[model samples]
Target: MKIAFPATGTDLSCLLDGRFGRAPRFLVVDSETNSYQTIENDGNADASQGAGIQSAQAVIAAGATAVVSVHFGPKAFQVFEKAGIKTLQADIAPISDLMDKFRQGVLPRMQGPDKAGHAG
Candidate 1:
């Protein structure tokens, strides 16, 4: 399974980004192989409108089956739900610890967006 995470940097040692839509990048981890890919979110983050939707689409296009973030905007959460991508929420923490929480089932599955949509 490829799980996506809004991240501060390109690797597991980095912290998870708190703002999902404006995250610098997304770390897509392959649970099976323990390998990961970094998907740049700079372009989406720069969008004055629809940053959440744009980021969601990028994650979907990257083939992410799940998303782990501190919070999600309504539009982005809707897109993920519609696409069957599961979402889990965690407090700001190291990317490695977040993934560990996910694997341990300690992270709560998000039933809806935690934050209101941004100016988009």
Candidate 2:
């Protein structure tokens, strides 16, 4: 499965960024092969509005089967649900550790948006 994590930097060693829309980058990792790709999120990061929607679209385009992040806005949550992508709530941790936890099925799936829309 391909899992996506909001990140502060490009690599797995980087800390997971807590804010989904404002995250600087996204690390999309393939669990079976451990191969990954980094996607810059600068456009959405600085977006005045619709950042969550844009970010969610990016993840879908990146082919992420799941997402691990601190939060998702209501609009973004709906997008993921429609795409059949699962989401998990994770605290700030290294990307590697978060991936491990996800593979072990220890991370909790998010049922709804943790905060309101456009919350930053």
Candidate 3:
């Protein structure tokens, strides 16, 4: 399974970015191999509108099966749900620790967006 984490840097040691859509980048990790690729989110990072939708589309295109982030807007949550991608809530932590929590099923799965639309 490929799990995506919103990150402030490219490596596993990077801090998890709190803003889902506006994250600087996304670290997509291969669970089996422990390898990862960083997808730049600069486009959405500065977007004044539709950042959530755009970011969600990017994640889908990157083939993420699940996402671990601090929050998701309503629109992004809907997009992920429709795409059959799981969304999990995670507090700010290292990418490695977040992945461990996800692997252990300790992270909470988000049923819906915790915040309103267009929240940066």
Q: How many residue pairs collide in each prediction?
A: 0, 0, 0
**TM-score, every prediction:** 0.95, 0.96, 0.96
Instruction: Give me candidate 2's TM-score against the actual structure.
Output: 0.96
Superposed by TM-score, candidate 1 places the C-alpha of residue 89 at a distance from the truth, in angstroms, of 0.4
Where does candidate 3 stray beyond 4 Å?
none
Q: Which residue ranges in model 2 land beyond 4 Å of their true spot?
A: none
Q: Each candidate's lDDT (Cα)? A: 0.90, 0.91, 0.91
Displacement of residue 24 (Cα, Å) in model 1 is 0.7
Pairs of residues at least 3 apart in sequence or in different chains that clash in candidate 2? none
RMSD of 2: 1.5
On a 0 to 100 scale, what is the lDDT of residue 13 in model 1? 91
Per-residue CA lDDT of model 2 for 1-120, tens digit only, reads: 899999998888999998998888899999999899998999999998889899999998999999999989898899999999998999999999998998899999899998788653
Cα deviation in Å at residue 81, candidate 1?
A: 0.8
